[model samples]
Target: MASSNNQQPSPNTHHNPLFDEFRWVIQIRHSLEEDHDDDIGIPVSIFNVPKPLQLSKPEAYVPQLIALGPYHHWRPELYEMERYKLAAARRTQKHFHSIKLPQLVEQFTKLEHKIRAHYHRYLDFSGETLSWMMAVDASFLREFLQVYAVEEEEEGKALRRLSSRMSHLVDYTGRKSAHNVILRDIMMLENQLPLFLLRKIMELQCSSTDAADEKLAKMVTSLLKELSPFKLMENFPCIDVTQHAHLLELLYCVIVPQSDEQTEDNEIEEQNDDAGAPKEGRQSYGNSGHVKQLFNSVWNVGSTLNGAPVRFIRGIIVSRPVKFVVQLPWKILTGLPGFSILKQPVEYVFSLQGGQENTKVSNPLDASVSRPPLVEEIMIPSVTELISSGVKFSPTNGDLTTIAFDVKTVTFHLPTVSLDVNSDVILRNLVAYEASAAMGPLVFTRYTELMNGIIDTEEDVRLLRERGVVLNRMKSDAQVAKLWNGMSRSVRLTRVPFLDKAIEDANKYHDGRWRVKTGRFMKRYVFGSWQVLTFVAAILLLLLTGLQAFCSVYTCSRWFGGVMNNVQKQN
Candidate 1:
């Protein structure tokens, strides 16, 4: 797929419709070289689920690769993939042909909301979801639901309704071709035996009556049929707490949900925006082909104390939710100003307006001329810090190791945003530079540091040598147009060689152009189904017929009158 024709996408263009395309290409390519073992098993270790490496198809994962230009070169195998994409695109064009742009946006919004909950572990689910927030391949479950299922479609007004395409994925996950070899058997070949075997096993575990809900039952059923839960019991022991727990266990169950409720109350908190923190724009499609694009609404962040203003990106979400859970991105929130449980107040300084009196203000870091610019430091107080500060803990090292306090949770109110585009459009979703490489120029360095972590001045000697390197990377073009909204004041620039304003002008036209198409089929036309085009033609014909009749009648009346007048004159 990496052939010239299927070029790798720019890291930021994650709006990709197919995140799993890359992985599928890899698997298919490997299949070419390796022998297909008909006996090879699908790995179905539910407790040991794999980590997600890529986004899935449908609306599940966005492609982060930025659009460059026409791609060169193509692998012969990629032709097959291209065909699949074409079919999908054609399907979308047809379904959306009858729906207006606004209605299309609303449909997408509903789908996004339904899946957003699934992206996270249910807040009601056991605490296990939180621990795997960053680690597990939650996409395993997502793909298991989406890939095998057929997408619903209604093209060209042909009234056909099929079951959800997602069900196939769910069904595939539960297939059990081999008794002991669960997933290994199912993934081996395209046979129905594996599916049959898995279903039998689930039937043994929980009766239909025992299921909590239809969905919960399906989840259990899929797991049972695919993995051979009955066979796996021989090698793997399952601890059924419901069977072994005593009175204390029953008491704990009653207390746990209440404790969960209390924890949630304390966990989520909303912080008002800081006066100094930069604000970004949001984009959404609106009525009549209009777009509401918010731009340049936040703060004035610059380099050196008052250096020229700079451009910076915020962050983008990587996952959508399912069920009732939502996993907010940590990278986006890192730069946002809030109560960092780990941060300490470095110092406060007063901004002098016209006063000579020394004043104390909470600026977080002092920026006055008298004091050296406050080295912006992010203080992280570990459990050790808490203990050192005499918060009272006396356990030995190994005894206290169970506490995973390295992660500090901060909750804030997230604004209501639609599903298509995110609130922070400037924050491109992909990272091209390797985290191992040295940091970039000044403005970018600070921006990255805000998302990552502070630089260590003591250990790193390269910090002193990067001033010129950073300055040389400044953007030269008028990409500033990408920043401000439609209301900004104008500026004049002398056009130059090679790089002209023509490109910008053409881009402006393309970006602003709008085209609309619509179609509808009414149940019955009281006007009697003379198609609109045919009706208009009939009206034109009727008008011509009336004009002809009027001319004939006028000619006869004048001829008769002249004849009578001649007879009277003769008499």
Candidate 2:
């Protein structure tokens, strides 16, 4: 009894593994419940970069020049940008008459809870720290946009000072510019300020007038325009800007707008739908249909499925002419109405049959009908193979809406993409955003995937360069190929049927067995050298001549023997 009182009880008394595990399970469940209770609202748009994708290419997803949001706000590498942020904050204060920087900080401080709810990951900063970060970022962004918004005369002094400050970031002989890197960083998916702050800041800065809304729109549009490679900003359709969540969403809307007409059409189609089956014009191109389309492309080869000989057309006329010599002539040509008329054919040819058309045709090549569901896999010929197969590649007018593939013409139209130092950064962020967003357009992702499949080697890059499809500003073609191939490391593709169908068609045309066999035979034994073809022709001619001579000799011998035998018998 004394031993039982003084000594420890049996080791199994309180050391049950099952009980320990059960307690752990309860603790985990309680923690998860606490986390769920802490979450106040639904986070739909902005998201942290998935671990797999981030791990694959961390540098591309992470910002280099600046950190605009809380995700990278505390990183040691981004400390250099903090001074610039402070400078931007000081500049931003001058823009506001009523609200000073401290007042603005106070305003964001009051809305700390609301702002924190937007981020997907748990931010580690306290409320005060979080608000301060938001205030600083918001102020810098406004000033940055304002600098680009105002005219040269209005912002000349500011621009010069800004340039002076930024000059240290880039060397004079360097391939990249500081401004481009900043633009790329700002466009990153995770490094975005909340749209509410942008609007509120704009409101505080605007005059008390109805033009305030238009003023805000114009400012945002101009800022986005200066950053984009495509200058079609002016043509962007009016959208409810209030629906946008951030700069990335605004940029996306400007690029791939869901027009009111399209919305009405979708509604009408939905109303008319009878069961789960799609209507005549809206049929989904399932696996079977995709295969048939592929077969058709291969079967037709250089022609359409209906046996019509297709005409090849260049999408954009590439001219890096001797500028010193041709500039004067080009300027003169530009002055003429006839020259403008000639230019219209190339610029507006694809747009005439763009997605706005109303007709519903069964043919995938017809632009009047909705495009078929893209193939399950993305496939296209390498640049070298496409050139060898007689397919032409030309640049588009920097608008992705112009991306089209005409199997009838055996031509592929792509945007005149400038492959600068920031191209990879800009493209990858856009892809990451698309992957994260609930319904982000997959246009950019599909384009990169298509480019990756086609640019497998340096030869492919050379061919693309020659065709003016890729204006590679980088050091080498291998670098260009590597940039694209690495972009799709962990990307998940959705069904963008038109893009899929186009790529599949291109692959089918290039990889068709019959076409491949014929090309090989011509390139190897016959077209290997002119001498080989001449030798084969000579051998065939000699053989034919020898056979004719042999037949003639045999006939003469038989006739002579028969005549001799008849004469002898008669005697």
Candidate 3:
């Protein structure tokens, strides 16, 4: 009312707290709208490690040397690395002769919204602060990753000349412990920088776009090969570095190459062709299908015995009168003096020769015609147990796809794995990354679980090392055992068809042995139920004691005699 057309209003008129809050909410709404606009089409690839995953081995997931992204950027413990990061940023600036550090930061500021969208968690830093952080982190990462770059002969000299500060921190030869620790930090789930930012930095440093792409790809590939536990084969597929989210994702792609279903079908077909299996039987049996067909031919004669004479003999043998007559001869032969030994031999020979002819006729209708039960879990024996059970362990110079179990030779083929102090950290982070990002099967996680299952004790590690399947760079076999055991604590059960099939084959082979069968029977019947059997025995002993005590007090013999006499009199 303008204070009633001239009268002054109180100063508190517009000072209502409720009104102030409403305006503040409007401001917040606009800010959120802006944020939503920035995140419209961007997909989040980086994630803060879940608390449950961190709780098992917090050090493995947390960066020990440097903080790469916003997730752990403010941790006081990692603040010491800030000076080094700044030094590396300065060194990186020298490489871009025309583009200065400030210009690089400006470019990052322009991409701030895009950078924020990559992280799953909310970033509380202002645009300027976040941009500066990305610039510095990307610079530091670029400098460190230079050591792993595949340098050409012309550029090798220039690439080898790292700054004095970085030289102490990152050894070109990767012999220093500090260097290894930084490498581990770079591979952590939380300490990941977006690959786009790295690409932008590389593009700015290089002469042209194609050169930057080529250099980045080479650097990433070399880094993966250096850090990977599995030795990459010569024919390993090339990975598109730009397509990945970060270094960790690129490394995962290198380790677990995605093969299409059609390719797998083709490989199976090729293997069947190598084994000379018929096309019609190819799908039913696996690698050993040809061998099964060969064994199946042993009973094929039964099919040829389907004539009238064979049918008449079968009908006569099935008659009840024939069965009675057959039993009379054996009974009479066994009853004769000095003919009992001959009776068993004659009966055994006749049964052996006749049983085959009868059994083969019914083979088509036998229970063997039914499909075997499915193996739900991968339940292979430990390394030591397999060796003791006469199952052989051999290292294959191929990828995870090369894991095979030969039934005839009782051999288990596994890929060679090189282990070191940082191997556990690398493996744990890969597993965590896969859990967060994978849309298909967790093949790497399944592989880790397989190793954990087969390595129960130090002796198992020793046996694997002896066979060159596990290259142990740790202090002892016990350390290797402990590392695998600790990794399996948070692992969830998963099934990879090929790995599971290999495990099933190994278990079947192990179970088929007489010693293993005997041991299983003893464990299932004797040791497994010892407590219940003991309780039943105690109850029986107690009842017997009570009966003896009653006999001591009252004459039980007389009681039984009187009952018997009464029964006889009644009869």
Candidate 4:
């Protein structure tokens, strides 16, 4: 009877599928809990480049010359730099006298978990491997900085000793040649050590007399300035030791520096905006009080001083619903020289510029030369199209931080931007860093977006070149246009503070019936061909001649007929 009952199929066996499902859920829950705890207070500096952003330019974000961190430490192509890394490590040991590789490895071993926490991706290397990697890479970086320091301190000493790839590194930063690919590699967000690690190494390396942090800042800034394609504005933001999270963060600070007051103002403005924010696509700028906030008062007032001008309806008016009374004759108003500048002191006093109440700190990033606030919507015509539409391009003395399009003057004031082989890698990495940063200022990204919209063809590049806005060291103008076009694919468009006004002005101009029709006419008829124009002119001339001939013949016939009739009457 017991055998018969057992053969009837055990009750638990029938419910095995349910038990397996329960076990699976339990495992998933445990994993979720473990991940949550692991993520607590993790210092997220290096991030795996998001898939969407990487699709545009994958190679740009990855290191090609040297690997700085555990992320790409053992890539086969990059294995060539391993020997250079070893050489750098040896130099580092020799410089420090007693400090050896084993001691550095020990330090790294103790700080492994903390270092690992900074990276968002799961690293496959075991504790021993990670520690060894950090030691070697950190040594390489420290020695790299030492090379720069030695070069600056004792000019020709380090130059003679540098070999192979190290020799190329020096040249890349100095002359900017084919080997300058290394410059882009080192600046990538993924290829970074924790600033704390570098700081620790600096502290160890510096003698009791030297200011380590100051020296470190100078070294980093000097290195970055050498590699950067963008011109660093004079008195550009100084690197604060307290502010940087990593090397990439340091680069970011140099690229986009904001004063403490400005940062606070931005934060307060953001909070206020968030407090009253509406649903997406329903944002009203008119009531938000930031619509005409493109340029600082300095720019508007400066533009006014130059003949191209802007007048504040605010402060000048005594009451609500301010009235502007212009009672001058049209000829006098239009032709009178310096008429706009008659009330220079009064206009300056009653300006609506933001920093009027207090003496404002000058922003190095601000446009050095001021132009009138753009009146039309931002129309980003191709460089060729803009030139065809009577817009002139002029080179600004200022850097890229001061790029402006003035509609009133019909001129685009742009800093001379260099386009070369290294430009793509440099720009792509800058864009990637900006995209990944927690609170990255989108200055470079915005500039790229603006350029992308304007440059649709090689002709645009040619126009920019003619105007001296671009210094093309690359293969072709088409490549320049293509580079800009490729950049904005993954970038989510957002409102850029200064560019909003320019964009509005451009859109208004592009969308205007007169401008569109005139452009079309020029492209279709006037600018089409000389043969077409000549043929049309000849046809008109033939028609006029035929009419003249007919009139002359008719007049003669009438005169002859009148004479005949008179003769008949006399007979």
Candidate 4 clashes: the total is 13
List model 1 lDDT by residue over 1-571, tens digit each: 4596468677776675634567656645754675535323432111111122012111111212110001100234323333323333334334333443334334333333222222222222222222222111111222232222322352212212212432222233234222112122122111011121222222232345233233333443343322221121222222232231111121112211112122222221222332123311111111111100011112222222231112211211112331111222323322344412111110000111101133432221122211211122222222222222322212111111111212112111111111111211111111111111112212111222221221232111122112211111113211211211111110111111111122222222222222100011122221334454364577689867875785565564453567788999999
Q: Which regions of candidate 2 fall more than 4 Å away from where they truly are?
A: 1-43, 160-176, 209-216, 229-234, 237-241, 257-377, 465-468, 473-478, 519-571
lDDT of 4 by residue, 174-276 (tens): 5645246666677777887877677666666677424668777777777766555555256655676645767776765565534333332221122333323
Error of 3 at 109 (Å): 2.3
Best of the candidates, lDDT: 3
TM-score of each: 0.16, 0.60, 0.67, 0.61
Please report how far candidate 2 places residue 217 from its true position, in Å: 3.6
Every candidate's CA RMSD: 37.0, 19.0, 16.0, 16.3
lDDT of 3 by residue, 287-391 (tens): 212222222343364446764435544666558875554445445644665444334333332322332355542221122113221212134589888889999
The prediction achieving the highest TM-score against the true structure is 3
Question: Ten consecutive residues with minimal summed lDDT in candidate 3?
Answer: 279-288
lDDT-better candidate, 3 vs 4: 3
- Model 4, position 394, has a per-residue lDDT of 83
